[model samples]
Target: MTTLDGQTALVTGAGRGLGRGIALALAAAGARVVLVSRTGAEIESAAQEIRSHGGEAVAVPCDVLDLARFEAVLDGVGPVDVLVNNAGTNAPMPFVAVSPDTFDTIFDLNVRSTYFLTQAVVARMIAAGTGGSVITVSSQMGQVGAADRSVYCAAKHAVEGMTKALAVELGPHGIRVNTIAPGYVETPLTAPYFADQEFRADTLRRIPLGRLGLVAEVAAAAVFLADPAAAFVTGSSLVIDGGYTAQ
Candidate 1:
């Protein structure tokens, strides 16, 4: 039997990229997945792909930044056994040139959404009297500072803090909260940056693995943390940066 058999998982921003990869991985482990995203078409397409692979999945279109709509989306999905707060946005601008609006946009989606959504999901998990996992997709930026990523780093740092606090508060209720910090995964969001030969070379030089990470690699980490194998683990951040942080 699969590790996640008989569980229900919700992966936000699951239309594509890292979120989609995590959703598919969870489904492969025998969980019925709920794909949440702002774009209905993308989520639907992803759900269909999961179905084609004999995995059970459904698409739910909702913006994470909108609490009301997010609550509605939660209601539509009913009780969720796992909630992957993977929806996030980043505007890479120098600290001196960053605007309030830019900061708010990133925090609203990355921090606010994660905060409230976890509250909602943990409430349900408490009521059901069963343990559940809440995994947030953080970044290496959260751990270390980087140029042109001040706001992004702040948001992810907040996410890491929240993860710890939530884990402490929810431990009594059998709910696990953790953050996955990826170094530099190859995704649609980072594709442009990776396309630049100079940038790519610089990034590769930092990673001891000498290559960029795959979405599937990050997804596998999610699966490990979400499954019973990690039952004793909580209030932690898993760094999947291929030795970038090691240096």
Candidate 2:
């Protein structure tokens, strides 16, 4: 009698971090999860752990930056009830030092890859007549700007805009599209920044909660948005920023 019983969820970037957390959460809720990532060992280990816990899961390793291969991987995995587009990367550089290569690299993975992957998933959802949830892992930077995060902010901002637009266009079909904008979360990607005393203090000071967000916290938000209880919710964002955006 779990909320997601019998549903299938596909979570990209599922090898580790928030993606892995979300995948585990969905499976715990009774969904069969397709764990996708660029690294085979990482996704496989994650999928095995889910299986050991009595939840159904499979690993599909493919770099999402390659849209064609990503689409092919999705085709093989079949239709999904939920899609978490969480594959993203950030290169923090001052605006003056930001080059075209830096911008494209970040946007290609964060925005472009997410955009096309969601498109493919929604198309399958439409064809099957079984509407699904599309959740993109955005960031607090998407809502409020930060120093040396110009490209990251730009990319996440694009994701937010697309989510809202997609929700508007797909709501009539029973589809839900939303983004989860989380503050500094303790993940492999952000670990280095946290290791710096000055940076860590600066980040924590901005959060009213006085702590970094955990991957599980963000995952829980994904579960809420994916559940049938959120059927009426769309074209919105759930910010898990620990009150950072309040100020």
Candidate 3:
């Protein structure tokens, strides 16, 4: 049985969408969850929902892009048995149109924040002598490229590489590191893009599943990765792209 009873999980960007879904999943499995997001209200609402469902959760509002504040956030939470680095952003622009500012913004959140957060959390995990699970929420774009998504792709690709390297470094301490590379998921942030006729059509045509993924679907995958059943699974990507990249 895959159980997370008595575990503690910290999910970044848990205000809504995929992060909220992942937090709910982990809490449902009996883990005490800490929900982190830049918006205080959003994260508080998420925490309330979990508590209403008989789960343990705390809402912490902090901009993850500010590395110092983020490190402090982790310090307040103490040792985490599971760390879900789900906070990230994307700016789709033509390769030629992408400016240094655009590249820096995406990479700062998607790659830099994730890297440092993992480092801080893992240090506590090692000191506590408790092997933990680190799940980085990446995207199918990491594995393949797309039009007007150059910077996003670059950031995700960097994450894929970082995961592999971290896994090898942490494996000796029994800490596992991996990423969940999902396809186009219907979220508030992505709804606008999917609403466009041309964008929706092109996206659906590429996915063999012929539809967008649900936040719950991605959440379930994270649970699987965080559970003990996946003890031997490290440095791997659970691709949930509905065959979008299969071609």
Candidate 4:
């Protein structure tokens, strides 16, 4: 019964999939959630679902890549106790085939957005003098390279790097920064690839657990890291990859 009672959390990319799961889990744990995503309708629907479950949530349409708009979105929501940097993009292409544009797109969404959003939110947390948690949703690719995932791996590795740096800088301010690395979660974003039976089987084989992860499982990890239960945790990556990286 980990509770975030009286805490306010903002979850980026909450329109669907892992983001949605994290948002709902936080709300269920008694945190007032702010759901942000480019899709206003989807976020609104997610907020409504939270309300249906007797949880509190608000919807905000935001494109995390827009640094200018990032502050505005936070301002609209007011003070936050937790910031989940879950917005990211993946351009799966062989290293040789990856173009500059693809690299830029992946870095912009996955790395840049996480960096600046944490900056903005930390400013607010420091001002309020309230200890806060920053959770970045990274991938197992950050720890191990996968074929045709060069750009994504780069971005996630950058995420891990920043997480460690920020933990050092912000720990003095009572702000904890950490990352959660998920491996082969079954989500809409990965649905098409999983539909390929051979690809899905191979993925499962790599995960020593013998199955793909669930959105709820990842959500639970996010909630744990964000909760005061992990107050002493920082600069650490809690890998929820079902032993995918153990080998």
The segments of candidate 3 whose C-alpha lies over 4 angstroms from its true place after superposition are none
TM-score against native, each model: 0.98, 0.98, 0.98, 0.98
**Which sections of candidate 2 miss by over 4 Å?**
none
Model 3, residue pairs in steric clash: none
Q: On residues 39-137, what C-alpha lDDT tens digit does candidate 4 reach at each position?
A: 999999999999998889999898888878879988888899999999988978889999999899899999988998888999999999998999999
User: Local error of candidate 1 at 5, Å?
Assistant: 0.8
Model-by-model lDDT, in order? Answer: 0.92, 0.92, 0.93, 0.93
Listed per candidate, the RMSD to the true structure in angstroms reads 0.9, 0.9, 1.1, 0.9
Give the number of colliding residue pairs in candidate 3.
0
Error of 2 at 17 (Å): 0.7
| Superposed Cα deviation of residue 121, candidate 2 (Å) | 0.7
Which regions of candidate 1 deviate over 4 angstroms? none
Q: Per model, how many backbone clashes are there?
A: 0, 0, 0, 0
Better of 1 and 3 by lDDT: 3
Assess candidate 2 and give its TM-score to the true structure.
Answer: 0.98
Model 1, backbone clash pairs (residues 3+ apart or across chains), number: 0
**Model 4: which residue pairs collide?**
none
Error of 2 at 213 (Å): 0.7
